[model samples]
Target chain A: MLARVFEASGLSSVQISLLREHTEKIRPPRALFCPFPFGLALGKPNDPEFQHRVLDHAFSLLERPSGPVLEDFPEEIVPADAPVTPAEERPPDPAFELTALRGYYDRFVAHHGRTAVGLTGVPSTRFRGLVRLLERYAAGEEIEAPTPDLSAAQYARFACDDIKAFFREARMEQYPAENGPQIDAWFWQQTAMGPMMRRVRDRMLASGDRQVEMLSYGIYREPDTPNPEWKYLTPTAVKTDGG
Target chain B: MPHLKHLPDMKRNEMLTFPAQVNHDTPWTPPARPLREARLALVTSAGLHRRGDPPFVSNHHEPDYSYRRLPADTPAAEILQSHASAGFDRSGIQRDLNTTYPVDRLRELLMRGAIGSLADSFYSFMGALRNVARLEQETAPAVAELLRQDGVEVVLLTPT
Candidate 1:
C-alpha cells in the first residue's frame, strides 16, 4: 500500500527490514534489492543519487518478464564508500524558521480555536520536535524525523489540520494556517484514522503473537451488527480476490 | 503480428535468467480474447500521484511513485513525457498505453465507441511497496471497491 500512500500524499517513502536466517524466506520473485544493509534499504547515509539508483533498480526489476533475481552492489564499487558527512555539516536555519514552532502553535489555535491546552492535549514536545525537524530540512539537511506517538486522548479533539500543521510545521518550517478555518477543521474530520489505528493494532497483535478474542455484551438483545461469515486470519485474508 | 524493440544485451541477459520456463508443454497462448479488439483497462504504478491524500502520500520518502490510467486518445507524447519510465521497446510500442488502461484516456474512447464502455474506471497505485501483505489487505480492497463500483470488466495490471 506504499504506492497508495504515495499516490494519496504526494510523498515518497521506503521500508527496510533486516533478514538474518530468514533471508531465504524474504524471496519476492517480483522484487529487486539494493546492495545496502537490509535495515538500511534505501541507501547509505544522506546520498540521494545512490538512493534514487536503488529505487530505479527496484523499478526496473518489475519488467523482468517473471523471475527471482539477486541484486548485489558489493562494497568496493558501492556508493556507500563515499565519504560520510556529519549532520552538523548542514547550513544554519533560515531567519523565519526560528519562529516555526510558534507558528505551529498559532496554526493549532486557528484550527482548534480557543481550546484549553489540555482539551486538545497534544504533547508540546511533539510540536517542538516537528519544528526542529522542519528547520533542519529547510536548511537543506537530509534527515528523517522520529515518528512520534501521542496519546489518543491528547489528540482526540485536535482537528486534522492541527496534526497536519504539526507535520507541516515539521517539514516546511511554516504552517499554512491562513487556509481558512473550515478547510482546516474539515481535513481532520475526514482523515482516515481508522487505518492508522489498525496498523498500530496489527503491530501490537503480532508482537503478542497470540490469538486474543474481543467479546461483546449487550443490554436487552442488542441489534445485530453485520459480522461477516468468515473468521479473521492474517490481514491478507481480507484482501483475497481471484486475479 | 507486431514487433517490439530489440532487447539489449544487459536486458536480454536479465531476461534469460527468468525462472519461468516457457516450452510447448505450457506454451503461452491467447486467453481467448483478441487483444486488439478487446475493451481494455490498464492499472499502472507509474508515479501518478494526487495531492494531500494521506494514503497516496504517506510513503513519500522513497520517490514520487504511484499510478494512473491513460485514455485511448491520450497522445503518446503525453504519456512519455509524464511518465518517462513507463516507456517500452518500439515493438511493444504502447503508442498509447493510455488506450488500454487510460482511465484518463477512456473519455475519448467512450465518445468514439472504441469499446462498449469502461469497466467502470481504471486505477493506479504506487507499485514500490515492499510489504505486500498490507497492500493486499487494505489498499487492494479499496481499489477493488472502486473498480466494482465503476462496473469494470477486465483489469490490466501494468507495473512500472
Candidate 2:
C-alpha cells in the first residue's frame, strides 16, 4: 500500500514480496516475488553474499520501464540436513537453565524496569514454566506425550519467543530513545541473556538436536560450499510463463 | 507450489479475506535519471524500528497506523523486528536483520555505485495492518511526504 503511495507521489518504487499471488493481485508498481520462507524476503540470514544478490535483483526492478510488474526469484534455497537428535539423547545447556534465565530476567527488570518487558504476554510468574519447557526441548526430551494442553515443541517456541521479546523490550527501556547500532550492540554484547541465548544455540547446534535445527531455521550459516542449484529469476522465464 | 499453500489453517482464511486495495489507476513514475544517479530510500512493512524506538503495538485491536524513521546509516544490528504476524517464518530475520530490511545491502550498493545515495531517513511500518482506510488516509500520505521531503527518487519496499 505504501508502495503505491510512493509511486503516486512520483517516486519509482518496487516491493520484495514473499507472496506472489498477493503481489499479483495488489499489483504494486513493481514486485519481486522471493521464493523464501516468511521473514527471509531478502535472502538467507547472515549470508551477506546471498543477501547482496537478493537486493541486487530487487533494485534492478527499478530499471524496468513498466508498471505493475511482478517477477519471481528463480533461486531455490534448500534446507541443509543437519542431524536431529531426539531430546532425550542430548544434554541441556546448563548455562541457559530455567533458573539462570529467570535470574537474568530479574536482573534485567531491576535495571530497566518493566516498561517494555511485558509485551510477550508471558507473565513473570510463568517464566519458570517457560524455562522448563525450553530446557526439556534443548535436552531432546519427548514433550508431546507428557504435556496435555500443549506439545513440548509448542511450549519451547513460546518460551524462546517470550524470552527474546523480554530481552528486546528490556533493552529498549534501557535506552528509551537511542541510535539503532548502539542499542543493538548493547543487546547482543552487553546484555547477559543475549550472549546466553547464543551460547545455548551453539551448544544445541554442536549436539545436532532436531528441536534446535527446527527452531534455528533462517539463522544464516555460510555453507561449506554454495549450493549449485541457485538461479536468479530472469525476465525471460517470466515472459515464457506469461507472468 | 506456492508458499501460501503451507499456511496454517487459521491464516488461510485471513489471507483469502484480506481486503487488499488494488488501485488500477496508480500512475507509474519512472526514475528521472539513470539508475546510477537516482537517489534511493528503503521503505518496509516488516515492523522494523531502531533498537530504542517504541515498537509497533501488535496487540492493538485497531491497526496501529504508526511508523519508525530510521536514519540511513543505522547498522543492521541496531534494527529490531517486532511484528507479531504468524503468516511468515521469522527465524532468519531474528539472526540477521538483512533478511527483511536490507539496509546493509543498500549501503553496499551505494559504495559500489550500483545506485545513487540513500535518503537521510528510511521508513518502516507493521505489515499486519488490517485497517486500510486509516492506512490510506493517514499513514501512507505521511510516509509519502517524508520521502518527498527527503528528495528520494526511488524506493525499495520489502514487505513481510
Candidate 3:
C-alpha cells in the first residue's frame, strides 16, 4: 500500500511500529516502537490528563530522529519478562461463546448491510466469514499467515465473492429471522468490543507512552509540492499562490 | 420510581465544567524530547473522514472517531474548515487545546525556535473503534508502521 500510494503520488511518507518484527518489512523513512499495550498506542483513554504528559515525552524523540526507536513505555504495568496467558488457562464459556458469535454476526449485518449488498451482491456470505473468523478466534486458533488485507477495495471484493456462502453457513432459518429481534440483541452484545478495546487501551494508558501514530502517512497532504527543506511533518500549513 | 432533591453547592467556582484557567508560569512538561521538539501530528477517533476513504469499515463502529493534523503554519480558519471533527470552542480550543493536541502549533514552535526540532512527521486517525481486537492487531500495527517510517516523534491522539 505504501509503495503504491507514495510512488504514485511522489509524496513522502513514514510508518511507526509498536512491534520490532515489522522494522524491516515496512521500510519507511523512520520508525518508533513502544512497549505499551495494543489500543493505547499513543496513551490511555479518559486520562486526557495523563495523555498530554506522555505526548510531551514522545515529542522529545523527534530531535535527530534516526532509523527506528523501540522504547518501552515510560511506566511499567507488567514485568519486563511476563508469561503469556495460555488458552487452556483462559477456558471459554459455552453460553458466552454462543452469544458472542451471534452478536458478532448481528453487528456484521447492521454496519455493513448497505455496503454488503452493494459489494458482495449476497449478504449471507459476509456473515459466513464473520462466523468462521469469530469461531476460529474464540477457539484460540492461530490465524493462518497472510491475514486477508481487508482494505477498502479488497473488502468490497471479499463481500461480493462470498455473499452466497453466508446463507449456507449461518442457516438463518434456525433463528427468528423475521423480526430479527434476537439478532438485534446480539448486535448490541457485540458492542463489547469497545470495552475490550478500552481494556487494552487502559494497559497502554498505564504504560504511559504518548506519541501519536498515523494509519497512513502523507495520504492527506495537499497537491502542490513545497520546497524540500520546508518540511511540514506535523500539522502545519503552506502558503499557496494562485496559479 | 422516586424523585429526590439535593442542595446546590455554595461555592460559585463549583459550577465551572472545564479547566477554565491556565498557569503559564507552571513548568509546562513537554512530550518526549523527540516528540516535544518534532513538528506536531494528530490522530483522532472522531470519524471525521472524507467522502470516499474507507470509513472505518470494521464491524465495530465509533461515530465519534475523528482526527486532524494542524499544520504549524495552518491558519486557524483552515483548521476550522479542515474537518468537522475538530469540534471544540473555536477560541480556547485553538490555543488551549494546542497545549495538548498541538500539531500545527508544535510545528510553528519548531520553526520559530520556540522548540529545538521536530520528528520528520506525525499522524492522525478517527478516535472510535468497536472491535478493538482488530484495532490492536490490524489498526495499531498499521499506524505504528506508518509513524515509524515517517520518523514521527510525537503523536497527539484525540479519542472519540
Best by DockQ: 2
- Name the better of 2 and 3 by TM-score: 2
Misplaced by over 4 Å in model 1 are A1-243, B1-41, B47-49, B55-101
DockQ of 1: 0.05
What are the lDDT scores of the predictions, listed in order?
0.31, 0.61, 0.31
Q: What lDDT tens digits, residue by residue, belong to model 1 across residues B51-159? A: 2222232221233233344443443333321221101111011222332223433344456554355453445565333235445456555665555455443344433
lDDT of 2 by residue, A1-243 (tens): 778777887888888887666666666788888876656777676688998877778777877877677888889543233233322421244233434445555665565332223323467667655555555655556555234644344344444555655554444444444323334344444444444445444444554544344334222122231111112223342221111
True-contact fraction per candidate equals: 0.00, 0.48, 0.00
Q: What is the interface RMSD of each candidate, in Å?
A: 20.7, 10.6, 22.3
Clashing pairs in 2: A74-A233, A87-A139, A87-A140, A87-A141, A88-A140, A180-B78, A218-B92
lDDT of 3: 0.31
Best-fitting candidate, measured by lDDT?
Answer: 2
Give the docking tier of candidate 2. incorrect
Cα deviation in Å at residue A110, candidate 2? 22
| Per-model chain A TM | 0.27, 0.42, 0.28
Tens digit of per-residue lDDT, candidate 3, span B9-118: 32111112111121112111223443324443455443323322333332212222333333344333232211211111111121123322445444555665655555
DockQ of each candidate, alpha-carbon based: 0.05, 0.22, 0.03
- Residue B115 in candidate 3, Cα distance off native in Å: 6.6
DockQ-best of 2 and 3: 2
Tell me the alpha-carbon RMSD of every candidate. Answer: 18.5, 12.9, 21.1
